[model samples]
Target: MINPFAPIGRGVLGVLAEIGRFTAFAARAAASCFAPPVFAGQLLRQCMAIGYYSLPVIGLTAVFIGAALALNIYVGGARFNAESFVPNIVVLGITRELGPVLAGLMLAGRVSAGIAAEIGTMRVTEQLDAMTTLSTDPFKFLIAPRVMAATITLPLLVVVADIIGVMGGYLVAVNSLDFNGATYLRNTFDFLENQDVILGLVKAAVFGFIIAAMGAYQGYNSSGGALGVGRATTNAVVGSIVLILALNYLITAFFVE
Candidate 1:
């Protein structure tokens, strides 16, 4: 028989250590972000890589989610003659919840894996060592730009996702579900508040931070050459998704009331 308390204590200590490392890395990234001879070119490339390239996947996810959410709500709401709530449900679900969450997860997979692989490759090739030898701050030059680009671009992506998602729901409701387009539009506009949109943007920003930071942190701290880099990439993606879900709940509780 094993000691339950021993396992619990180890788990707690491991969590504390991870928290400590994460906090230190965040502080370093924040410092680098503010004090910069900014890498505008690199940042722009990252924006394109992270935002523009991600649109199709994000858009498709949002559209299907919006459609299915409409169907689900319509079916359930009709039980109480609440079919009119479809518009409200679509707008609220997309703008206030699914839009940010899905976008973050998608980007986490794309952006995080890219960051890890790129940085990991550099690490394997000793390019990072060269930068250190030249007195270049890898944290500032390598990590900061990615973090800032992700942090800025995610909100933009979320905005696009929100619009596309709502449009998707509208299409399905009007064409497939036999609802009037004008009434659907009016209900969507009337039911969703400014706070809903603003809250989503906020969540997007937080998710972005999580994605970039986790990727950078894992890649930067990676070990054991090729195998290690691969492991780091996998860990970064998984970690970002888990953290995004956890943060979503916290943010929802704060905003939903």
Candidate 2:
């Protein structure tokens, strides 16, 4: 007789095993972060790579998203004669939800993949082994800096995203939707609260940590050769995105409910 549940059981076990391994990796990285002869230069470089260089893409994305969101909300609100609520709703949506989530997803695709590819290539070339021989701790020198950089910089990125997104919505509303610029701006500020922005920033920080950690974890474990590096890159992006989305919901619920 075929054991129908065997595959399901195996899948569950595999997932659990991966989770366990990732948790252990994260713990080790965290320990190294605190015990480090801190690499300030590397951390600064990573911050620029992960945060500064990402601004253009993140800004472009935010602008388009905000514009599209305003258009959609305006169209929907027209049906109920609630068009006056557009500015308030757009700002609220951007700050409380869309800003952080979109920024995280973007970084997962860009930064996470890059980290994985770089580290995976090093691993394949036995560079990490050489580091060990040179008495340089890979976790402290490589992983900790990237992880700390992401965690610290993500919130800043999200803040910029929020501002740009709000501005995009304002532009759309005032220009395309026949809204008074002053009135729209006033409504946006009036309706937005500090807590809403705070929640999004918090989510950004968490998502940043997840992106870098997943990338480092996948790359550090990868073997084989080019194929392995490619696989690690894919896994890092996929894992970071999935975890970001899942955790976003949990954080939102915690804050809102």
Candidate 3:
């Protein structure tokens, strides 16, 4: 007789095992981050790769989202004859939620996949093994710097995104929506509190850490050959995006409640 419960039990065990492995990997990576000989150069390079190179895509995404958000809010507000509130709402939405979340998601797609592919390729090519043979710790040299860079740089990226997004909204409101430029800017600036921006930045940092860690974890553990590397890359992006969205809600709830 086939035991139906056996399949369910095995599936649960597999999930638990994966969680355990990921936790262990994260712990080791965190430890390596602090106990390092401090690879400053590698860290800087990663900062450039993860933060600087990502600005164009992030900016473009923010502008379009902000513009669309403004348009939507204006249309919705018009139904209630509250269209004047568009600027206030737009700024609030961007700083409190959309800015960090969108930036994080974009980076997850770009940075996570790149990290996973690079590290996965090294793993399959035995370059990581070669590093070990040369007395270089892979976690410290490769993983730690990337993780640190992401954590540090993402907030800055979010700040830029926030600025660009607000400007996008302003342009649309003033030019297309028949909004007074001065009033729009004033309402945007006046309505936002410091805590809103701070919370967004905090979320960015956490998202950044998750992005780098997931990429490194998936790549470091991948086997097989080219196929395995591709799988790791996909997993890295998917995992980072899922974690980012889940954490965003939790963080928002914490701040709101």
| Model 1 C-alpha lDDT per residue in residues 1-257, reported as the tens digit of each score | 98979989999999899979987997898789888678888888888888889989999998899888888988999999999899999999999899999999999999998898888888888889999999888887889889998999999999999999998889889988999999999999999999999999999999998899999988888888899999989999998999999999999999876
Off by over 4 Å in 2: none
RMSD of every prediction: 1.4, 0.8, 1.1
Candidate 3 residue pairs in clash (backbone atoms < 3 Å): none
In order, the Cα lDDT scores of the candidates are 0.91, 0.94, 0.94
Over 1-257, each residue of candidate 2 has an lDDT whose tens digit, in order, gives: 98999999999999999999998998888787788499999999999999999999999999998999999999999999999999998999999899999999999999999999999999999999999999999999999999999999999999999999999999999999999999999999999999999999999999999999999999999999999999999999999988999999999999988
**Model 1 lDDT, full chain set:** 0.91
Candidate 1: 10-residue stretch with minimal lDDT: 34-43
lDDT of 3 by residue, 1-51 (tens): 999899999999998898789889988888899994999999999999999
Off by over 4 Å in 3: none
Instruction: Please report how far candidate 2 places residue 209 from its true position, in Å.
Output: 0.2
lDDT of 2 at 22: 94
**Per-prediction TM-score, please?**
0.96, 0.98, 0.97
RMSD over all Cα atoms, model 3: 1.1
Q: List the residue pairs that clash in candidate 2.
A: none
